[model samples]
Target: MRNFKKYWSFVLLFFSAFSVFSQDVQFTQFYANPLYLSPSFTGGIVGYRVAANYRNQWTFVPGTFNTFSVSWDHNSPAFRSGFGVMAMRDQAGDGNLANTRMGVLYSYDIEPFPDWHLRPGLAFFLQQISIDFSKLIFSDQLTSTPMPPTSVTQPGKDAVWDIDVSSSILAYSDNMWLGVTWDHMLKPVATFYDDNSRLPHKITVHGGYRYITKGFLLSRIEESFTVAFNYRVQDIYRQLDLGLYFYSQPISFGVWWRGLPKNSVGRRVDALAFMVGYKWEQVSMGYSYDFTISRLGLASGGSHEISMIYEFRLTPKKRWKAIPCPTF
Candidate 1:
């Protein structure tokens, strides 16, 4: 049994290495992490906005994936510009492999026609990846009961740093919006060893529409239904999220389907996510859960995510056009 457990540990470590460097952390609640989604959303608001998000994936696993992000952004109505700062951290596996990112972004808004606007954005990030070599178990060490140090050469560096860049453009009106983002334009080198391994570029295209309905009893009260989709591709991996949302005052509900229904590469359905949110005054908070449906099944223990947003204005407030997108 001990030998069997050690073998699985080696298997887990091998897979974790690939996942850490090959894939980017994804949040089920895309809008909740606007700055992370697209730099064009940097200042997509009239006033100051702050957001925080957390996600835990595959809880049943020993070394689960945990990610966290925080961002702040605000728009300048006079200059028709937006600026923001963001940071994120993602960690996985018992080896304590981690990635940290910090960045600043800018966006400028242009009006092409009446009630329609376009935003172009750019961001620069500093990325760092680290791992604890001491925690790793080698194949030679597993051959004996009292594991002896194997003749393995260390990478010489505990962490690696790189500069990354991303750009995006958004076009929107009062009730509809569309955006596209190109990430990792720099193809930053991501390796702890002497060899060069570049992080692949990712492309994301997202859009949404909202339909507003008036309340029967109160004419002033408005309820809205939104349909949104986010499609992303990185390397050979493709992920699509289709979601429906309903918002009535302080309450919001959402349901999302991830992955493709019919694909030539076998069963593509990954998970179904459900979300609930609440807003009071200037603060909005949300929680979501992903139900794993793939071959991993329920044993993966699913994923959980939480997000919060606060919007506020400074003195001498000025009216600015709001981007028509889902708030959660």
Candidate 2:
């Protein structure tokens, strides 16, 4: 029992201390998790919007990996701006390595060209991270076979805090949108140790286009086909997601491919995700199941994700012209 714990715990710490660990958690339904995708999406809605997301990954792995995020954004018609707040938490490994973040965003609306709308945004965030050193068993701690005679002092601190900056821009037209985001501008130190290792910079480029037809065979039903993709890079790690969605009235379905790597060590074709969504009035919800295509295989129990969103108006105010974008 002691041998099992020691070997596994050290493995967890070793990988986490290196750059192999992703500093930020990922979501399968990128369109559903708007704020986490880009700061410019903060208030980029017809009205006030609230969204929540949850993901569970690698059930077959020794430890658990879970991530959750919630955010709120309000598009002020009078100011023609977007304001939002987001909070997220990710916990992984048996030692319970965890990262939690909170952020506030503000975006201003601009029109660089005639029919295109540009939204530029800025965000300030604080992060807190922790790892359980008591669970880790080092070489010095193991004198003989079973364990050490005396208790080993904890290796790392209980928790560490840091502040960071991020920015994003969204450019959109009637049926198309393009967005880019940059994170970890300050490259804050992430480890519990006294060393100088810092967080790597991350950039994401995402866009989508929708082809709409007013009515289907049924007069009340509307039909549309949409294609979207996201390309993200953090240090040497890169990921790509391409998806196609078909919308018929209140229901929508989509398929996405995650990974599509760039010859990187840790980045490989990871999963294929199937998603379904429904919307009624101001409320919407989405669910996705990821089929692991990586070396982990189906033994990982794949992954599951769900998102909920609500958009509404608080008071009757003069509305600004809205840019057309996908609801999910």
Candidate 3:
């Protein structure tokens, strides 16, 4: 009876929420890659910047499940505004399901105080989702007991259209910054298989502060540190993350901890994240690893991510204020 109940629960969850329609890409280090989450983060750095990131997840499980993204952001110093373009592709489960998204963003900055400025931004997005019904394998018991021939064939590829809006308020000095953003203003249906079932939109709020301490331990070495956190809430899940970063001139390092909701097995799972990176001139390269601590750990080897970013000063003729190095 206990086994039957567990199986029933799994079936209900799978049909209701565990399917591909509700699955979203998970990021262990969102602060290091802000553009992946919010379009308002475009041009939050300085000058013209280009970034690329690749993520490999659930290595412990078989088959390929990975995601890749690329984005470019540029700010006009003369106009004090910015624009960006981004694209992403995700594939999972033997290519039975895939998702692709493209976005364009524009932002305008307002100077409220002598040293502080607020930026309001907007982004328009296009999303495409595809599912392969032919590749899906149903349980033998259900397939063998089919009542009608027409019921054997399932719905084929589903293409969906959706829109999202976001805004952010940023305040900064020479060395520190604080910002907040709300994403996915317009929730859209992802599952064309059933009109009654829809994926819930997600909301995230985050902020960070950085401090540069000179001559901390010795004259030659300087320490730069940052503390950051974010809270994300959705219909069925909520996550909280806290992280700290430390860096010297050439090499940077950081660690983070993420808390997850209790699972059906009554286990509280968490993840340990570590990052390392190097910066040279106007280019930076970084990588991060996440180790899961839960019953699913045996099935998921871990997760790996790599990112690269480049920034170029667009206004060569005008003398501009120095912009701090971007952490995201």
Candidate 4:
């Protein structure tokens, strides 16, 4: 048992050191949200939209992390294309990182029948990642006995460039829709160590279906049910998440279960997420909390997420009926 503890401790130290150079950010509960990480999700809505999100993780753990992001997306009716931009900043312990991305999406609509429309889109993205290494605290064990205390002065900073190409196919009717998207095609590296120790890229595939059932036992209370699932695969690990959402016109609630990766040796971990949101006119607010089912449950408190979204429609006035919208 002593040897086992030492082995695991070494493993954690190695991963923690490597994490200083990795560009990939970790999230606790992913299925409750989608647009937080993927730039290709731009122009998915009907009109011009803006979204902002903030997350606080592991409240029980000392020196936990916080992440904040803001994004704007707009689609052109005349050009049948869309554009979006997003920026994010993450801070954990003493290390701070920032990312900015710009995306352009071109979509083509296919009319397979009278009532159904299929839209396939291709998007190009450019991202810049910057790291501030001065804040990081290296392990004291790395130093010799009677070593002097370390100071934050004379820290290192590094930056990297990454490009991503993604594609999505969306099938929609009046009440039902399905979509599939692929991200992180370039597999850009952002390690502080040797260039060969590259971070692995991830691929995710997801789809969801919604069903509306009206008036069984309660009057004026209608139920909208949805089932969503996603699979994420990478070189180090993979995860599968499935959940159900029950919603009315003004409020929504959801519960999810996440399956552990096959190679994970730790106690199986699951998440119970509860989400509530309200829609008012063209604006919406959402909040979710997740509780873990692993041994760390006592040590790592919980995760919290909050988001705000707004949408605006741009349409031609009656007097502009004769004028055609400009194309880009």
**Alpha carbon deviation, residue 300, candidate 1 (Å):** 0.8
- Segments in model 3 whose C-alpha atoms lie over 4 Å from true places: 1-23, 141-152, 215-222, 261-269, 315-328
Q: Residues 5-81, candidate 2: write the lDDT tens digits.
A: 56665565556666324456778888888888888887777679999999988777777688999999998867878
- Pairs with backbone N, CA or C atoms under 3 Å apart (clashes), candidate 3: 60-301
**Per-residue C-alpha lDDT of model 4 across residues 75-190, encoded as one tens digit per residue:** 66555555676665665554555554555555555558765666676767676666565554444434567654442232254666678676667665544555666656666554
Worst-scoring 10-residue span by lDDT in model 4 = 319-328
TM-score of each: 0.92, 0.88, 0.82, 0.76
Query: What lDDT, from 0 to 1, does candidate 1 have?
Result: 0.87
lDDT of 1 by residue, 156-210 (tens): 8989899999999999987899999999999887777676678899999999998
Which should have the higher lDDT, number 1 or number 3? 1
Q: Write the per-residue lDDT of candidate 3 for residues 154-245, one digit (tens) a residue.
A: 44535666665556655555555556666555665566455555556666666666677754321223568888777676666777678888
The Cα error of candidate 2 at residue 21, in Å, is: 4.6
Error of 2 at 264 (Å): 2.8
Clashes of each: 0, 0, 1, 0
Best first by lDDT, ranked: 1, 2, 3, 4
